[model samples]
Target: MQDDALFPLLSALAAVYAAEPREEAGRTARHLLEAGPSHLGAAHANDAILAEMAAALAASDHPAVQAILAGAHLLPWGDNPVAAQAAAAGDIYVVCTLMGPDGPIPSDDFRMGLFWQRPGTYYALHSHDADETYVIVAGDAEWTAGDDTRLRGPGEAIHHPSLMPHAFRAGPQGLLALWRWSGDVNTHSYRMLPDPRAVAAA
Candidate 1:
């Protein structure tokens, strides 16, 4: 059945995090494996943007990437109104939390999911109390945090300390990354910073 597809992706993603050397990421991963899966409602499905990202992930040979692609459609997809506006300007972003408050699989302390952005898009700076990590599954991107900025590629990972303002721009090929959040998982605490691009010019 279609619902059964999430388990493999969950398993593979948890395995990757479990093997991670970072204590917080590893702890969250282990907890995710133990939490099991949840049935997402119809609200989670967004066929247009998600379908395209899923296809890209499915083309990968990585087990975790392919597993997530298998069930991407069934998972809940969400977007920010401001970010959606950028989509109207030809930039796009789609996210689905696998665990935690907004995700299908609910948990008290951790959140995990996928984030997809179209080519030539900029994610503008944002910050949160929860520590976060992203494992790039496909494509490349230039990620920025304050004075720090680096180009990242598939199979690479980035960690952002809690409350650190950060953002990233999708490359010509776009970007698809698996992300996780732990500690202070309150979604209300998420805030968008002043546009760094604008701040620089001023």
Candidate 2:
């Protein structure tokens, strides 16, 4: 939470990364990143630099940007999970995991790697601090706002600027998407957040 304490975590990780063989560390980082920042889900973004990254993501075209622009742009990583999932899913899988979105912290901005959905599922209603953009990479998706609906396919996108009410459901064939948190997601808010029925009914 505090700048003074942040370095210790980084230092611990750095120490581990330095001591491990390069190949092993590389493998480890890949695993961590793939896990979608859920571990640091609410922690990492607390940093000033991370906060800026969120904003950069908010204002840029992802998977196709050159550098940080308007202080809020980000390009997709080549070995990014979407590429990997698309490769394995034949253009129809949920295509893999949710984006490793940067987390909470006012002074910071963030980006979401990519968040897709499996066929026939509702992502539930959610919202965050940074404005965001979702680009459909493959297949189709349906985003909902109250009673309104927007359907999209590859190359199509939806933008939700901070606090706007929204929700998504993948198409019958699933969805592949890229996302952006157009500003600091220092305070992500999910509307009607997920809550499964605790009772199992027959």
Candidate 3:
């Protein structure tokens, strides 16, 4: 898809987020939308899985939602090499970042993206300086935040406080979620707890 395809997607994403009943989430979405430019570029790392996800979204009742996702720039899960290794082993973890300090329309205050993981994969415990929120757009997962854990499915949103340890494992059906971050957007602040290398070795 052309880079111009991203404008509608960004607008839709911002609309959905701005309509969030939660005050904080709505405010954050509006802030990002207002500050971000309409330009976007492609990362194009995972073509096959991107097609699958687009199809799945297209099949949903919300076809417009799928249209928005169709323009995503799929990214390799290589920022954390050990996690990348797990994905290489057929787990199908995919990341599509939409806005960040380094993304198309750069922003220092927040970032938003889509994340997908195949069934049975463990997204190891990790923490970051930015407060994060994940709104499940498809599939299911067992989500953990601090000592709290729950089975979150489509339409549910999970929030993680800044620097709070959390992790999740995709259930039998796999997981697909829309994620947003605020407060701190530094990429260097992400810390994988227990270590990705250790998890890979185990």
Candidate 4:
């Protein structure tokens, strides 16, 4: 049952990556195409935000965004494995890995997935060993990397080098993005840094 939706979802994502100008995007596209359809069962959680994410994606004009929304119901959504503490802080987000080591389509060296965050949520500063890139498929966000910050909307891309501190606050409509990780793609090194606002208050 999941394979029915997974195939089209992955195919659509491949098309999205193939159209990107980055070499990494091209490689990700090839990986997706080679993986084919596979099922990992439903990993769904945080049901409340799923509907909001779907609504935001549905409002987007991007084709990739529309494709994601169409297959969202079948995707294996799950919580953040690396930062469990974030949930306690009311910073909730979900992930659906289409291709990666733990995903239905296994790839040790890279990971490609979708990420959705609730509206007005702030994901505090964090860093990891993996080199990551996120392309906004729907909604908007204020992304911060080190000292730089920018308001990013649909179709924009943000890159974070290995171990570089980064964070983001979702816009009123929330955020829906396609993300990929490569180079030291291990969650073992993932760590959340102290929130600057808290530090300032102290």
Candidate 4, residues 1-202: lDDT per residue as tens digits? 6666667778888887887787888988988878776545665645676789888987798777766766787766773445454444444567777777776677887887888878877877889899898988889988988789889988877889998999888898999998889888888888778787534422
lDDT of 2 by residue, 1-202 (tens): 3323333322332333334344433333344334432233222112333243334334434332222222111212232222431233332222222233422211123444444455655655555566666655445657765446788765565767677766666666555455545455443243344424111210
**Stretch of 10 with least lDDT, candidate 4:** 83-92
Two-way TM-score contest, 3 vs 4, winner: 4
* Cα lDDT listed for each candidate: 0.72, 0.42, 0.64, 0.78
Q: If scored against the real structure, what TM-score would every candidate get? A: 0.82, 0.43, 0.75, 0.88
Which order, best to worst by TM-score?
A: 4, 1, 3, 2
Better of 1 and 2 by lDDT: 1
Q: Which residue pairs show collisions in model 4?
A: none
Which structure among the candidates has the greatest lDDT?
4
Candidate 3 per-residue lDDT, tens place, 122-201, comes to 77777888888988776677788888878987667788989988877777656777788888766666766774633662
- Which residue pairs in candidate 1 have backbone atoms (N, alpha carbon, C) closer than 3 angstroms, thus clashing? 44-76
- Number of clashes in every candidate structure? 1, 13, 0, 0
User: Ten residues in a row with the worst lDDT in model 2?
Assistant: 67-76
Report model 4's TM-score to 2 decimal places.
0.88
Off by over 4 Å in 1: 58-61, 79-91, 196-202
The TM-score obtained by model 2 is 0.43
Q: In angstroms, give how far residue 47 of model 4 lies from its true place.
A: 4.0
